[model samples]
Target: MARVPQARRQFAAKDRQQARLCAEQRPRAPPKTALGVWGKAAPTPAARRVQDARAHAANCNRSTVVLKRRGFPMMAPGQVDLLKKRGKKLGEGHFSTAVVTRWHGADAVLKAPRQKPNVGQFVKECGLLHTLEGAGGAPEPLGLCLYPLAQVISFAGPQTLAGYLEESRSSAELLRLAADLCGKVSEVHEKGIIHNDLKFDNVIVDGRGQIHLIDFGNANPQGQTFCLVSKGQRCPWLGPEVFSQHLSSPAQDAFSVGFMLDTISKLMP
Candidate 1:
């Protein structure tokens, strides 16, 4: 090589110094973790499946506009005052409260979240109920409310199965109710929806003794994983595998039905 000029040598050294500084300042790739790469834990297979299922539900099923066109209009905030005037508190739960009220001159149950932050659970329940519309053993979804965030559904009954069980009933009647409950659960499963929280509290029995399954907050599409974040209280009816694997299937609901039947059997005289 020919002798380098002093000016060129200085320029080359400065370039090298700048390159080293740039390399030092550049962020190194985050170390990979067992869960994922870039220091962000990757969502597990179960989580991904759950996310996909939720996304599908939100995109395809949770459309208030579609429901409105289908005859399920949303209740406005102004109507909430009327609801309060005519409605009677039915029950209260961790996330939502139910009230018996009149909607459009029909008996209806208005369920709203305990707080605005819990509106997501109400929306999920509304979407699932809409999907189960026309199916037997489920309450008819009337519409959804916006301001306070509530879902208007046909009143299932005056009492829940839990309260109904308190009344005297012959063994034959209990057995029949058990069968009816199982049939209703089967109907839901047929619709490809899993009522993850299946219990006496969620079952409404009309004066005619007809059973209706309510509360789809915990419901998920078949094959999706159970939502760990929003999991409710410890349920005796849940299968062991559900907690261990976080997977949801019709089998989990089956286990709950079985548990309910077993409990009813014990009540029989």
Candidate 2:
């Protein structure tokens, strides 16, 4: 081994001293799994029942057991108008009002169906958003509110990759963002879930440059009406068999990501 310089030797000695101090001063975290990942705390008895209720509560007319069991923080009705609407009316196309809203001093996009809201779709969307909580790119669904006529999901962020691509940017940054999006979508599909309405507008981006997939009104569980709509840019994101009403798979999500990358590239100046 080469002899250490005096300055270098002093730095290593200080590092060791700091490590020892930290080990003594810091509180220990809960034990991690064999793979060094933190293990999730087991749900309480009440929480378990809530999970079951959410799973079975297909429609908005959920049973009392569901309402009571699901301990979701209830936002008072009529609080919807309190949110400050921001940004340009980002080109709404769905059967809902897709306006961006600001809540709790943060940027969160809101989606509330205009026609009679689809309850099954609401449940699936909540499930997917909640499931992929911290995987990245995907926006966090702050809360899902059920109404008599319509339901709303609050997501954190603004405009999707499509909106970003509309302006000039570096190709490398675009590709990296696209790749990160693909990885998150793969995580979604791996959970045996499918986001039926996958498109640019549905993918929201925040100020920190993160991608969040939104719009769950068209989402469906494994054995539901797998209605496929191939409109506008949706066609490129969807697979060929998607036109035939075939159910979505993980590969379909990858294809959608690939198309999104292509679309982003074309818009770059």
Candidate 3:
């Protein structure tokens, strides 16, 4: 890991400290599940099987859960076949490809890691989702399997935040959206995960204007620093130190939210 410059590193630390405070200050909403709120579930064995499997939570996690690949229960090939036959195709990203399909007759999306190594990420995502499970405003994590290395999530709308902005002309609505976005990010930060990459393309906008954050491959735990792997050029949502200091934290996430607010400003007027 390349060491970030000390000046930028220090600033990131400060940013994270403030972000933590903001997260602590906000009132976190409880997850809404049929069983009850998160951490308070009395799910049947069958119900538990249908949702969380090992390291993957149907929604979010408080700590990183890493599991060995072998002997791990995986989704049957038949399950994968069903998704392909029943679901529609969604967009693909660098790490994985998604297929929207029917699960128990409900519309669903199956996310499979494109590479073997990325399987760990999908597993991590499950834990994150589990951590956030039953939480209001987050998408439902239907099921996850390891044999075929796949996860089944409820099929959210296909529209991107970028596309949603095209139809919005009201500054009031835009500001509300920005606040909602910040609120969601704050909730995630409180759980100690930094999305690392936050931008228009990474956010999903439902027809009702709800925003869902997607993609966690670049996500990192709060306060911990890693060698900047994407290396060199930084995305527009990234703060200045991302490239210069080579670190990721709640501060970077905070900066991304600011950058998004700036985007909203330019786009509105």
Best by lDDT: 1
Please report how far candidate 1 places residue 228 from its true position, in Å. 4.3
Query: For candidate 3, which ten residues in a row score worst on lDDT?
Result: 62-71
Candidate lDDT scores, in order, read: 0.79, 0.62, 0.71
Residue-wise C-alpha lDDT for candidate 3, range 20-47, written one tens digit per residue? 9999999998667555566575787787
**Decoy 2 TM-score against native:** 0.61
Report the lDDT tens digits of candidate 1 across residue range 77-115.
778767877899988987788899998888888887775
Q: Give per-residue lDDT, candidate 1, residue 86.
A: 89
Q: Is candidate 1 or candidate 2 better by lDDT?
A: 1
Better of 1 and 3 by TM-score: 1
Relative to the unseen true structure, what is the C-alpha lDDT of residue 226 in candidate 3, on a scale of 0 to 100?
Answer: 53
User: What clash count goes with each model?
Assistant: 1, 2, 19
lDDT (10s digit) by residue, model 2, range 167-192: 67787777777776877676666656
Q: Estimate each model's TM-score.
A: 0.71, 0.61, 0.66
TM-score leader: 1
1 or 2, which is superior by TM-score? 1
Off by over 4 Å in 3: 1-74, 134-136, 240-248
- Best first by TM-score, ranked: 1, 3, 2
**TM-score, structure 3 vs. true:** 0.66
